[model samples]
Target: MSDEERFVYDGAHVVDPLGDLEEEGEKSAKHNRAKVGSARPSSLLYTYGPGAIMDLPQFTIMPTGLDEWDRIWRRRGPTPPRIHAPRLRDVVRMTLRSPDVQLCPYPWQPKKHSRSPEGNDLGVPSRVFPQWLRCTGCDMLGLLSQFDYRNTHPYRTDLAVFEHAKCTGRAGSGTRKATRRTAIPARYLLACPDGHLDEFPYDLWVHRGQPCAKAELPALKMADRLAGKGASAVIQCASCDMRRPMNEAQGEAGKAKLPQCRGRHPHLDAFEPKGCPNATRLMLVGASNLWFPATYSIIVMPDSPEEKASDLADRVRTALGDKLAKYRDNLDLVRDLLGMGHVDVTELPDHDLELLLQAASVSPDTPAEQEQKLRDWDPVDLLVPEWQHLVRPIVGNRAEEPKSGLTLATRELGPGLRPEITRVLAVERLRKVNALVGFTRIDDMDRVGDLPRRLAPLTRTSRPAWTVATEDRGEGIFLQLDENAVAAWEKRVLDTDVWHSHEEAHRRNFERRFSETAEQVNHKTRLKPPRYWLVHTFAHILIREFALTCGYSAASLSERLYAWPAEGREPSAGLLICTTASDSDGTLGGLVQLSEPSRLQPVVTNALRKAARCSSDPICAMRTPQDPEDFLHGAACHCCVMASETSCERANRFLDRRFLIDLPGSGLGFFRPHG
Candidate 1:
């Protein structure tokens, strides 16, 4: 029996590190397949990811000059192959904007596919003001939300050269100076069932150099002189079934020109380019961005912090400059309230209210007392749910609702107009939340008050006292939350409102007793926010949930044990195989290492070997597919059990084989305790 069989027979609860534990096991919430890894399914989008959708708009432009062509052909060869650059504007206008590509947002019904009416499509949603932008500098095409897609494509040398030129910011010269000269042309004939142009357009170009064929010539044979001399060798066009005559084939230079048709026909000559050195073709996966009708530049929007603040100030000043002088006239009343003890608005003199109203109107353009006006202003002019709620109960209908649906509180106000009231409330709320959750009471259910400050004297700060919200049920946990601090939580996911509540909970837990000193608080928090960011970026958005769920267990995820050692010092090469007694059985048959080992191996090998057998398939399988021709396939093979224990020396030493033993000292111990 395999080690995996042993683990199961011994009652080990095996975990698949890469498996969707939340979906496959236990009572968890159901998730949409599309939103498994992204914030699209979450309510709090702001905290979901860093590239939050802020209001400010930004743009980027792709490369558009022809000079990029010459350099590309120099390295990759002149062939009618696929090019993976940004889609041109004309392409986007003709392809993506077509009605055939669009599907209306409706339920249960199959999406209607129709061609786009020329120049008649509605533009992007007006409400969206994107602050993030990605540009394809090579094709002079700017990637837009409505346009670009991702897919693997064959590699082409010439196109690669052009793309490199744009990346390096090197513009080419001549008639080809600013135009796209690098993209060679090739025709792809369709094997149509009804010969209908309306149903299908010709396949778009993919720049990979290799052509579609039943069998490719050996790489070594292609470079050898004797191989070329073989008269029986032939080159056939995939689209038209044209075979090149031996005399016409000449050499690599002759093969470079994409064959139009087989025979020496006038139509074939017109389609084929004579002496064209860059016309090789291939079939592969590809996608296009929004191709515009005409060339356009995407200008970078002003998002600098200073500039944004300045703009807001300028607008405010422009709006309220004329009223500044009247507000400052009652400076004495303002100063009295500022210094007075816990002075509520009702306690202030009538003159103070007048001054406060005037201050609210102060504009950013005011040259003199503008600063003073802002300082004396109350932030309540901005929306404050707490103050509004409080004022309703305190004032008891002193102010009447207006017929125009406008009031002191409900009136439209810009960000600059409501500093005092909004700022104070937000800051205080942030402080409250932070202090409430901070190191006050570890188990606040029964015990309450200054969370028995357990920090050593050197690390101690001012410890605040706490009270219980519920003592009888063991439910209350005191944690202060203020506007400024709480804003961080909202800001984290404000862009999309697709926030991760679990991460928010973790953040609150960490904030209770976090410090800047790495050594002091590093190990305490395992929020993995940065890791969340990376997973979404490199892989699909759904990878985040996978990582999060797996991370719950130190054994399965093993963030600590999964070490990415420095270059040239990677782990030893040990083949891990997963086998079974028969196709029907998922149980392990046997295990072995491909080679012998030294003493300095990892202690987790035995555990890994045992765990490997516990599942029908290994947990460490790569999510991506490998090249079928590459020799490294074995390195990532899904099958390949260890040969035998004698040859598996390295694996035995690296992995603690004791984990293979049938002992009862498990995490959930089965051994009896001493009496």
Candidate 2:
């Protein structure tokens, strides 16, 4: 039916937009279930995850919490099919404290006409939001139950909508003059920081704090003048003219006017028994802050030795074919057979022997297939694992070896490169996986480090054992700064007044944010080494410069900073600049071409030269943290070091172009400009 765009690929991988076209007049469409509409499965992870509001073509919806998911007829929630990304899963399990947690791609039904359960079930379930709606024809307003819903969507899905079918236009003080008109949702809603959402009280607003003086079941009407902003819109009671402007329901004015939250969760279709303690802020359906997803993202590591052994075991099984089936129950027999060199099997590692034993136990795949899933997870430190991959020698072309999703190769590092940049690598291919842990309202929760209450839940029931995820594929250029040069630079510049100011600002920002929540602050909350800022700022500058050379926009590209320096690992000061599914892509031709020796030399030089003086400079370069309340960035604005929030991991904080170039009195340029 629809070509749904799934996840927003952050260049860690290729974005998988799910679905095949539903052929017109297809026989199975006749067997279609009670489907209200469809959405891109990717949206479920990024844009429309559980508890987030969305405007479908016909009506508005808030997808139910994960507790209600199903494929059609099952009474219990669905155990969505698994998708492997073990490092990410372990991190989530450790964070949520559910040791056996799993990761899965968002569920879907590829076939529409099949009479089977999957085809019969709706992909994700949702409930109509803002229960109150305004009839577009007469401005008549009421709850969804009060309006008449019409569905011709089974045959004509787009036309499914609520209509004021009996509207004789403002069923008058004396007359009627209106035809049927489609109804639209009331744009306003109320939410608290605790993530409770509810319908705006139109009656309460129109009538002040009193009961409707005219009638008990008074009909309400909304009128938009279309001349100005929220102030121009008006609400009134049909029984009596108790009118109020829409602006009264916004900001502090609305916060003062509205009642305390009942702790209503529209997605769960229930209100908390004790009610919410925090005040509810008014939100429009389209507002950006209404829903924020807290997700864990990881670049898939190169296959581990154990995983490689699993692959070899499978190949041996295939070579042995039916002959291996008879020897399945005896582990010694299988090991000896592999030892006999019928399939070129090498000395099996303990990992391979374990897999072989499992294969021997269950005759290939029995119902107990999960017995084979026991493998050690990759390290929970995301960047360290990826850093290892980035630092390794890139694989040259090999026709005989099976193709991998990730193929990286080093470009010739000639004399052209700056001495500080150790090497240039062309990541011919890469994969990134993003998993939705939960969401929040009013605040953008931090996804890094150990912090409490960083996210709200996706389900109201038990802590979920599994969550939805999506993958993206892309290629990029990796630049590793000289480690000794960076370490020396940090020791020299870290104690300056300018650097101390940044450290103070970072401390204050962290305290002001987490203190109010009353959660314990980790002692590790101190500011990190200055090279992180250098590497992070460098990544942003290159993203902007590469847009001009690589034919991708500044927004399409993203940066993954490897700068988390705590006590044990090799000090990380590298970054990956990647993009997936861009208009300018010629596969490997775009990003990889820029990493070549001839092009890379000038590219890095020009990018640094450009950062030496921002267009907004003097003012931008001279900028610093002025007030305690505002301590996010320094010497970085839209004109220079600041990057698209989607690209930069830290929401554009801890950036200072001054660290990359001399800013008058501040002589902290890590890459001092050559005369």
Candidate 3:
């Protein structure tokens, strides 16, 4: 979906410059107000939760009060609560199984109560965080800590901030006073690279963290200069007669000037007893780098009976409901034993519990037979098993029956593209589950493999045991490339001097961004093989082509690569370009229609033809990876082979059109015309 369609307008965006209007003009004002309120649909409450900063038309808001989940649930007024206790419990179980992951549950405010006869209990919550607001009318910057729960209405916590103080900016009639004004979230926050977030230390910044003999309640003000830059912004302490520029609290030098992290988790209303040693940096609350969610995903394979076993477990859980909670301690043990073999009623020690366990382990094949069936599973790569399942011919097996979630069919390719392309699968329906394991700040996703200390939890409880997750459904086009053809092309490319230059440029870029230590540098030195480059470049071209023909936008479509190293047990190369949405049913059959042989042939031909010559012409085609303007890509740009960051799995890096089509200065094109 387009961002415009998803972006919502909070009521604060529609401010009336003119004060209170006359009685005759009130109708128009009311109509405008209603329109803005409707924009923030209740459905958003299901998608966003605390710590998640939602983009408003004017500013942003982080949904606070996740720590107050119990409080919110008790006071949930007329509108029924959206409860997912079962799903939440399941997610917690999954987190415990994955040792590398930490648990942090996203706030889920269901639209309606599960017990409600009219409501369905399958909805997920929105992940929007609340903000520390600053009132424009009285120029009062209020901290989230100052919010009084006594002022909270039964159902609406949003109104608590307005009750703090009435606006003093405008005059009132007789003994009356100015009306209440809404406050927007503060724009600035203090954070460390270790993912410790806290309120901007206005007092410590101005006082320089020294003991000041000033008034008990000192006044603090944030003034903006005409320059409209961080350097021009200043924070002042009236009592101490002190002031400091925001610029000094930014960048590398700012680390020395700022205070140490206090280890505050505002979203969960908690703090670390042991203070963090890392120095804090001034960061904009809405900065994209502040939150980088690390997610792990796997394609659902048909040949894998574990998929069916999982479904059966879910069915048993649903049937037992509250009764299943009692068996939580033995759930894993029961599941493991069930996977190995069926338990005989006569050999079972506990007769009463046998039925429940048997129901959960209802499978057609016996343990030994299932093991023998999987003996031929010689997967070439991590994704090879999934690719094999996609290409497999589906017949009359109940386990392999076409489900509503994912449906696939293979097709034959024409002679021209056949030598390079091995197989094509049209996916009619597919479901993707993205689990939020942990997050990092300042650092990129490359550091996900590091220790848990380097990552931040989604919730406040130290050493949490569960994390939140969401599922998306969609359609896709899958293609497999010939391993031999890819191997031959890779050998030719690696021998060329141009390939060596590309490798050196990649090395320089890596060292520049990361530490120079041998350990860090060596970890990233596994140079991307020519085969990866060839497949990655082709994926970009295909995505660009699919975006124009398919109804979905380029950003909505994402790529999944299946490639192997130079020396590996299995030699495999393939790509899956798919798009998914938060909605129940994924998308139209546009992508599936394009999977047809007649339709796919033209798309490939046009994409390759366009890649042969970019709009930038000889300059773009002749550019090398060593060029200062082009550090990662060669003979490629936005107008040619580059794609949106959301679409490319490699962050739009390690791509070169020369690998796909012949270029002016290089003869390393893998897809050059045979004639």
lDDT of 1 by residue, 370-408 (tens): 334433332222112222232233233222322211111
* lDDT (C-alpha) at residue 214 in model 3: 89
Name the top TM-score candidate: 2
TM-score of each: 0.16, 0.79, 0.72
Error of 2 at 406 (Å): 1.7
Per-residue CA lDDT of model 2 for 61-108, tens digit only, reads 787766556332142243456666766776776555443467766556
Error of 1 at 512 (Å): 42
Over 4 Å off, model 1: 1-675
lDDT of 3 by residue, 472-582 (tens): 678888898878788888888887887877877766665555443434445334457777788888988888898899888888788888776555446668889888775
lDDT (CA) per prediction:
0.21, 0.69, 0.58
Write the number of the candidate with greater TM-score, choosing between 1 and 3. Answer: 3
Rank the models by TM-score, top first: 2, 3, 1
Runs in model 3 lying further than 4 Å from the true structure:
1-50, 56-132, 145-164, 170-179, 211-213, 225-228, 306-382, 393-404, 415-419, 447-451, 460-465, 512-521, 524-526, 617-619, 627-630
